[model samples]
Target: MAGKHLLVLIVCLILLNLSATFASKQNTTTLNEATACIDGASITLTFGFYINSCPEAEPIIFSWIEKAVSDDPRMAASLLRLHFHDCFVNASSFQLGCDASVLLDDTPNFVGEKTAAPNANSLRGFEVIDAIKADLEYVCPQTVSCADILAIAARDSVVLSGGPGWEVEMGRRDSLSASKTAANNNIPGPNSDVATLLSKFQNVGLSLQELVALSGAHTMGKARCSSFSARINSSSSIISNSPDVNLEYLQSLQQLCSQSDANTTLADLDHITPTTFDNQYYVNLVSGEGLLGSDQALLTGNEETRRIIECYAGDVEAFYEDFKMAMLKMGRLQQVNGGDGEVRRNCRAVNQLGS
Candidate 1:
């Protein structure tokens, strides 16, 4: 009788263990679903993915996507790829080593390609996503897609670099092709006047107002000495070239590039209020101190565009609302949805080699 009791007790213990394991698995599955849904929504809103349906899927997917980008440095690099393409579109000669055509003036290093330096303007924003990805990897291994990772990383990057914090809906599947050609064709240029900038954004369903607001992103980061050479060289009348930049703030930068040498560094067009996500970019336009050629063009170009720029510049809250809406629109561009692309195990590489 005692032997029979022992056998019954062993069976009961096994049953309890099985039940606990099943419960744990269910909890994990639920969490994954929620994370994915949010990530998908953020990407859809920001990049214009499968706009109609992905709203439900975003929250579920973000956990995995967020983890992949913030956990690994390599994953952050992969995410930075998208931003790199965006930045590349602003100029004709980003990677050409030395393209004199993009020179602002005769400045020595004030060349457009200066941002290409490994330490200068390269994907410094990826650090935020890298930290998140590391934590996610520890909790869930091999469960997230790198493409989603890229989307989230891009959103976080904007906020990290002293801009507005965007609502990043995740669960984006990885992209199979990283088209160098497509990237080159789509990006805008530093010399692009207001009209050109408007046409490009409108082609993708964005508006002129949005174009001006999104340009506010330029507020953060360093510009190569080359980017501002045009303003300085156009006339010695410019104060920056005459007195040398103030030492307390601008002194170190002047020393780094030299005063007499036209190789001077310019703040990101929106640097006056770089850390805050606000209407200062537009306000800068009103003040006649806008940075990039493309930026000033909004004010000086066509009448309709100038009116819109003025409106946004005058009203801070209006700019914030419009900027958010525009950001959501830009994030959804040309995304392939629903089984069109693989959920890449490694964002940098496609599917696992042997698998």
Candidate 2:
């Protein structure tokens, strides 16, 4: 009878332990599902997410960005593009939340997205992000997220570059991993045609109008000659013969993109106003002076895109309005927040146990 009682007691203890473990697993699963099931429109991001916890967060990030851009005006475009690339990769899949995955350094378990084909040698401004994160960490410790810093820096970049400014929704957290495959597959390349560009945008729930507005971002950046050399060299290129493209412009491009200089030379996307954030990108497209195949495709690809190009070309105010709205919408894609993610001590790697 004593032996039986002891056996019964052990059995009851084992069952209780099992029950607790199962409950813990179930809770973890539920939390993960909640984290993965983000709705861009209904996300919990706010205008002043760190107003109390880190009141000086935005000003710190903005000041850093302003000083960086003041030193190198092109840094404004680089930071803006960085934010877009980071968010676009996250928007590729629900599982890949908008965490600072793009900022991750390659680990044994995974390769970083920064070296992926679409991003390799193309994406810049990582150093600026690192610097901003370092400053925030010094002041706020782990209170601010790298993702939020990215969003804010992007906003400040545009403002300093003479573009419209919009309120950035914050409270994003960093992810544990980066996705090289997603970055390569989802990011539209310079050679992408209209259909490809449209599909890529639509995959992230962006509209055709939004696509046009976002492409306006190209107004301030420079493209490598490699991105457009084929257009100048290809037999099918209308650049050499098109009535819309100016002959002097084509000759100049040909000279700039000679075979020997393909990898080293760069061209402004908007030759007329390369440093400003305006509707001049659309104007360039309308005139067939677009620097990349992708840029020119906006005007020549579809009637709808062409109409948008025409509209933006004529009305800079309309482009600015739509660009701001599109940027806000894009920034919300697949965000990870709440208890599902963490604020990394460093932007380039996940926080270690002590560090």
Candidate 3:
């Protein structure tokens, strides 16, 4: 009986060892899978991504952009807006990543974002991108990605237009697809109310403070009369009823945006410093001189947003600092890095072979 009990005990010990070994292997596999997923997602793109591969890429881009902006100061704002529009599309799960999808022309199977309602005839700066890309291709072949070019151009635009500059994280790759439906749905409209604008920004993980700071990009751009004529012409508009709007400003806008020429006439978004990038946009908002209804909505809608507008109006340095950080954060959204995407040969079209 004692011998039988010893045999049973040995058998139980063997089974226990087997179970332990199996659990150990299972835990290791789970850990490895988790680590790989984390590594894939956390692709930290640095500013020196092209230091070895294409040393002169940034300098070449800077030279062309500097010349372009020197000839046309408005090109800075256009370039900056191009970056914003390109990065703002729905990039999370849909792979509409910040891959210069907005620059793609419409193909039969895929409709590009360039002609979306908010972007049609409004978004400029494509020629500037083409010029820079052509120069880069000559110098570095396919070493640089259009996504990186757009990001760098945006940084250069702010510096040229007298705003603070930040180091743009590089190493992003271009997407193989473009989505007009995503662009039309994602890009905020000029007539969007404060709630809608907040929702759009929040959808992309941006905060209200960031939204207010980024909106200050309007300091250097011009809005067509069609963008805001309804505010002045429509009797029920908040601008018509609010005493905050300067009467003189209203009269000037009315004169500029007559019904017949609403589409052609353009007005400076920041009348105080029309051609410069500064905190004057926030100042304009404080005084009810904001160019678009969406611009004014910052002050009129939420207390926190209004407070931010007031703070930026009073503190230029704060605005610049916040704007720099906000832009960097926006540029980092859903970026394609590592071997996840490819560097396109043409910014306007996807790489045909393997992107």
Candidate 4:
């Protein structure tokens, strides 16, 4: 932890000269001054929702996350993606927004979100959430919801990865069901164009600027070879008509993916700082080194998205502020009002009746 703090200090110092403030609704440093948050179901979420029922909720979740990320730096990115996946997919009537449906395991009756195109073979770190949920159930059975665990874990993951911290509004309930179909159709894909990306964000109440800011999460993770294969594959037409990318950079990606095991090979999203949670993703995009077509689309997209991307690339502080705001807003997303939501004793399965 001390090492990460020192690293953050060095990064901030190096980039402070390039700082410029973007529009922000509240000061991250002053949590009390932050605006109130409510879920899509119209349930008011508050800080410290488990202060009395589960006083150790946050501490326990943080301890497990800190350990997991320490043991595997990639775990931080995985957990962060969990919250992101959990927060979206509301396009159809299923609307499993931020309800932890992504954590569900398939049963004999229904398929879960795990096998969705966006989630299967891509998502990880579920065991960590299971372990934390087991401990929370032992400490205060059914007091802390899996949805809340995901939100808090996402925040702590960013903090541990040397990014800004924000208060995660709590009191979210776990969804009783999961939707593989919705996940397939709703979650944004790496191949999506800028218009589809912005439309999806708006469908869920996020702004175009928030889409740019939230995409900054790409800084900490990696992408599969399939994710950007079209961007540089000489045989594919996405290359000739694609946005300008550095020649050497495109060649390197092509070489990496051309390997015999290309299907399973992974490429760092931010080649400069693969594991750090910083605005370097934007910086890389500015250089035309963004890993996904969806990412480079931001640069080639309309003026507003491009302007915000450049703002973040030049201003780390501004990026951090907007990211916190966006994450907070995303954490509050909920699709259902009341039916079939519960504080599950197990994250992967709903409680049996009369247990």
The Cα local distance difference test for each model comes to 0.46, 0.78, 0.78, 0.80
Deviation (Å) of 317 in candidate 3: 0.7
Query: Model 2: runs farther than 4 Å from truth?
Result: 1-40, 91-97, 240-244
Choose 1 or 2, whichever is better by lDDT.
2
Error of 3 at 120 (Å): 0.7
| Residue 354, candidate 2: C-alpha displacement in angstroms | 9.4
Model 4 TM-score is 0.86
Tens-digit lDDT string for candidate 4 (214-308): 89999998888987777877876656665556768888998889885766999998899888999999999898888998998898867888888
Encode model 3's per-residue lDDT on 1-355: one tens digit a residue: 8974575455435334543653454356532231111111233577567868986676666666778899999889899999899988963364645678888888876888888987888888888888888878887988899999998898778877877665566888887677888898899999888899989988887777778888999999888998887677757457567866776777788887875578878899888887798899998988889888888878888888898888889988777767766776787778766666678888888778323
* Deviating ranges (above 4 Å) for candidate 4: 1-43, 91-95, 236-238, 241-243, 335-339, 353-355
In candidate 2, the residue pairs with backbone N, CA or C atoms under 3 Å apart (3 or more residues apart, or in different chains) clash, namely none
Candidate 1 lDDT over residue span 211-268, tens digit each: 7767765544345556555543434343343232222333333344455544444455
Winner by lDDT between candidate 4 and candidate 1: 4
Tell me the lDDT of model 2 at 64: 80
Per lDDT, the best of the predicted structures is: 4
Per-residue lDDT over 173-222 for candidate 2, one digit per residue giving the tens place of the 0 to 100 score? 88777889888888899988999999998887887777888999999989
Flag regions of model 3 displaced more than 4 Å.
Answer: 1-43, 91-94, 353-355
Q: What's each prediction's TM-score?
A: 0.58, 0.85, 0.85, 0.86
